[model samples]
Target chain A: MTADDGFDETLFELALRMGDNALILGQRVSAWCGHAPVLEEDIAMANVGLDLIGQTKLWLGLAGEIEGKGRSADDLAFLRADRAFRNCLLVEQPNVDYAHTLMRQYLFDAWHLPMLTALKQSAEPRVAEIAEKSAKEAAYHLERSSDLVIRLGDGSVESHERMQAALNALWPFTGEFVAPDDVDKAAASRGLGPDLSAIAERYNETTAAVLRDATLSAPADAPVRKGGKEGLHSEHLGYLLSEMQWLQRSHPGAQW
Target chain B: MTAAGTLPSEKDIWRWLEDVPDPEIPVVSVVDLGIVRDVAVDKGGAVVTVTPTYSGCPATAVIAMEIETALRKKGLDPVRLETRLSPAWTTDWISDEGRSKLKEYGIAPPVQGTSCAGAMKQANATVACPRCGSENTEEISRFGSTPCKASWRCRDCLEPFDHFKSF
Candidate 1:
């Protein structure tokens, strides 16, 4: 039998989800390349995007190897349909402004830092390896984003308002990241994936502390909104894919 | 350097690696920068395992080539190379001599005693000037000429320099 013939699909699905989060978030953050408020901010955001894309490449490469597919990382990244993407809706959302980008990054980085740290002990050596590396990068990412959240939130009235608004708008989607599901459950049972819920408390504690220091409060509460894990995404993802994949789709197998 | 039909020992292999300088920062060797992960000596040849400083750092390909060429020139044939992504390369891996060399080269080394994740909560440490040894430096940008560095300027020295990022 082939690698996928008799194996449980949860591992592949989990890996896809992990990669999609990084890839889509990378694209979103990269959108600010030329538009950032200052040169230093521009360079910083680009560095963050580069790190995310690098992590994506590693996760997808492992996914392809485990599936025994002839497909390489590029094929998986450029050839997939928008519906097939498993990234969170939060990552695919448009970058409305610098505050929005920072808030989104702050939320995700908090979750990513701890999740990757715990995943370093995964049963799958490849997964553990990827996590070990990503945890380091994610740490730096968290540091930058968290620092910005505090700076902007406490800087001026307008800046604080913008950051607060972004937090309110994005709060609902943060829930899905730590929400338990069957795939995550199976991975947790096999010791291949860390329980995201257990890590959620840590993520929450960290985010709350930053928010307090920033002089801005998180949204009081919101319903747990989710969908991207099941190949479902916001309308924004379709447009993003069209823009990202246009060149590749227009000319099949084109090389730089 | 080796003579014809004679195998190089582990000592010779490591010495050759130490002589191979980093492609981007030629001031330091790969071993001093801590990218050379493993050097395994076999009967016929040696296998070297390296970890790239960053995944997409352009210098990595050049690094692999430099390692091979350095070994090949020493009469070592078929020196196999492998890249490891796990336990990602950290600035903490830089040797004490490497740190001193970086300072002499006008680049501030990473702050000691900080890991990637914990770096977030730790308040900014004093970044001393490599040229004047002053603790008055302000980071200009989080990224610099290379993936592993940040751009900073010293208030006292009035000179811009690259600070090797902690991660």
Candidate 2:
């Protein structure tokens, strides 16, 4: 509990942002249910999605509790509008192909590892609890994606080119993870969140190592894209929200 | 007070829980699987602390309901199942009994001391076959029939088996 009410809201909002990333990405992964390249991969990826959605429940569950609005995790996940979402744009982007999916996963896993590791020391016990729990899963996910990236990038002509292209297109989105903003400032000043600067360095270094192993070159530095946290997102997020929320909206209060 | 028998002791409740088999693996009990982390009889009621095998295993709800059903069947009033996920559930928590049961039931038990992330780098990590007891085995797939197990086949016996993933 902070003395400042505004700070508390920012903290809660931060949780929402974090949860949105997991939920949206998980949803995207789930869409690959029967369509993954292979049967084993289908199961593995869906399991990964399931883990993320489970984590989403924990984060949004806590956020709902903190907000004290009588809303449940499902309420927060299903009822929220596109403009209200605060996930990083990378997560909400369409899964163009396996290459893009793996690339985006690898990138986020890089950030997720350090950010969650640092968050294990959060002032809020609940935040720390979720962080501690999430870090293990995050590590394994990174391992899988990291291994895949290497295999795909170094595998064959077709795979290598596809992976390289995916990396090139997605690298810019990694910037928003550590870029400081209002929520970052509030969380950092109060020791409620990770020190983003240190995590930023680790994330970049980790990504570089993985890319090197994959024999892929980092994309040339360019203007970094931003603003999913502030609720301004690309056109992709709207369509994603429409599909995700369609059932909830069409059949209000529907429960299995 | 509602005409059921007297409440069982915490120890007795734990013993009672041993009869409730896991919904997925019917050969092993939930307590043996380590999902029922703690059981207590407090002034308020009986509180059973649980940690699920994996975060997303659909079996969690079924296991919780089975726990409550068993408790109610025994007349334990106001039962509470609290999910504690901090330390997280790992294969190491599977009781010795659970491991043996898994093997006898045609599943290779998880290799302890290796975390799931540790196996991630080496996805096809070798394991002994439950049927042939041969160490020369290869993972058929990283994912098995269930979320917790990996499909493996023994080279020597040429028989397929399931290895409980340690994640």
Candidate 3:
């Protein structure tokens, strides 16, 4: 299913993986619309979701072209089954509360900004172009999430405890950020993208500094959870995909 | 009309595009926003290359349709709209006239050079109030009503306004 006629399958997987992360997380974030703690937060969350969904289109559009399939961004986003998704486990986790949502966003942005920055120099011209554009938005996202993580994590005792708990719960899935298998290694070796492991140090440093400021501790000796990168997602992803794909499934090609 | 078979000059085509106001900010034309990167007239038709202001801006489609509709009404049939991403769109590209129009419309124009990494680092850049001309404006939120803007309020005037994001 991953093979492509003219394009490298590794590149297609890379693009699909990137697109799926953005699409799933965007959908998750958008779910917070009208449900955030305050009006400003509600708008802010929706805006961030819009940006991610926008990036998803670029990534998925590139994926479709690489696959040489008639599929489009919409097809890949709304038609794919849960098992077919290539996003890491981190993004598919449930948004249990405001703290969990922010923590997830912060973790993702910390990795996303650096990843896109590295991908800006991708050997693939298209990848580089998309990365260049995406990195800017990612930077903005990271800046916002980092600030919030610090504010809420260090704010009140209740807020601090919630943030700490959220961090502890979410940290395990982060192991997937660096668990690059054969596909990632091949992409990195070919200069199509950066090595995931190489990006790990940077992600750790960035998140560490922000966590320190937030008065949160990284869970030491946390079990490393992997496999989402390999299309083995947590059960939460099935629920997310079911709801996200419902409209598309009910009325295929439904549009205004 | 120049002639039945003759095509309009690129400059003339640009002028026609200026008539296409941005669907979100109708005060400024797409050309004024500097999104209409290049206009090329060929035997086929006029191809207007546009760069999106934001990755997920919903106005992108509307703007494309508006451009096509405006051009087609001018008898320029088969207008091809192309999306360009390189050298990504920035508020710095907002023409001087566009900046002025934004202020006149009660929107704060982005500070020059804020699109770069240096300025992005400073999350709370002081923006002069569009309504009161007070530099005592505070950012209410980074994300605003539109993708390309941020919400801000003037301390002096107490009037909330949208600031076109540095991006």
Candidate 4:
């Protein structure tokens, strides 16, 4: 197929990455809908989840539109198999504890802020538009997560230990965020994506500062896992997709 | 008591809606916020579809009421307002003309690249003062009175202004 007729698999992959991140994270957040550490935090987490779900819908819808397929956002999100998902391993990880969730959010938000900033200047107007809008919400998510991390890290001996442990556990997965893949390079060449390497540096600095403020040390770097962008995900993704897609698969085209 | 020539069309309903200012901004109308997504008319009544700027935005209820009220006052008593959340709302939906109007209303419009990372940079970057049109401005706080705004102070004019959050 000529370049014009040829599908841009790279762009499609990038969109899937974004959509999966939002969808998975949103699902995790929604788990705390009626059960938060506090009432205010409960509402706050729910609001954040709502924002993420909204973002997921937009990204998935765009993905469908770009693919020129008849698949709707629901089809892309709730009808796909686990191996077909492109979400990061970090997002798919379970929300073990409040500290764990906060740590994961802090790390993800730290990386996402810079990545979205770069994406706002994307050559693709749709991607840029979504990035521009999402960046604002991500800023709030980062701030709130930062505040929680600092509080937990400095609160009590147990709290501090838990927060530190969470940080250590999550550190390895972070390496995947900055490591550029074929999709990243392709989008960067077309100005439709951000330079992940530059974003990585900024992410490291910002996250390091936050950890330092919380009296927590950064975890040592470890081997990074790849393949999420290639539709290869962790074992946890199968369970997630099964749950998310069960209703859609069971009752085809069912609507509330 | 109809004081007009004929019944308003869907487009006319939207045009008349121009007079309904946003309850919060007052200066900017709902149309400018991109909240008024679509307007349609049928034999039963007119349907005005609006998507909330934010999911938890308290202004949505008021805006819906305002739309119904405004239409009713124009003798469209059976006006129906619907809310849609599927596509989601984005600040990019705000038009250039709308941004200018927001600026003129003394509310510092959200900058072009208003993402979280960009906003953090904005906290340190030089922002034009809404009052004096100077580039000397400092962020007072990231969280403003509402979730949708940020507080800033201009050094030249020494006046505090609200910058609409870019989201």
Shift in Å, residue A184, candidate 1: 1.0
Name the regions of candidate 3 deviating beyond 4 angstroms.
Answer: A1-7, B1-6, B118-125
For candidate 2, the per-residue lDDT at A1 reads: 40
Best by lDDT, which number?
Answer: 3
Question: Could you tell which candidate, 1 or 4, scores higher by DockQ?
Answer: 1
What tens-digit string does per-residue lDDT give for candidate 1 at B1-167? 37766678887888888898988888999999998888988656778999978765678878899999988888777889998876778888899988888888888888876745555237567788888888888878778777688888999879898988777
Instruction: Note the Cα lDDT for every prediction shown.
Output: 0.85, 0.86, 0.90, 0.79
Name every residue pair that clashes in candidate 2.
none
Q: Score the docking of each candidate (DockQ).
A: 0.58, 0.60, 0.72, 0.13
lDDT of 4 at A18: 91
After superposing candidate 1 on the true structure, give the runs of residues whose Cα lies further than 4 Å from its correct spot: A1-4, B1-3, B119-124
Candidate 1 local lDDT, residue B32: 92
Residues A121-166 of candidate 3: C-alpha lDDT, one tens digit per residue: 9999999999889888998888889989999999999999999999
Q: By how many angstroms RMSD does model 1 differ from the true structure?
A: 2.5
Residues A1-256 of candidate 2: C-alpha lDDT, one tens digit per residue: 4545433686788789879999999998899999999987898889889889988998999888878778899999999988888899999878999999999999999998889889899988889988888888888788778889999998999999999999889888989999989888888889899778999999878888889988999788756899999999989998998999889999999999
Q: Model 4, B23: alpha-carbon shift in Å?
A: 12
In terms of lDDT, the poorest run of 10 residues in model 3 chain A is A1-10
Candidate 2 local distance difference test against the native = 0.86
Interface RMSD of each: 1.8, 1.8, 1.2, 5.8
Candidate 4 residues lying further than 4 Å off, grouped into runs, are A1-4, B1-52, B55-167
Using DockQ as the measure, which candidate wins?
Answer: 3
Residue A180, model 3: lDDT of 79
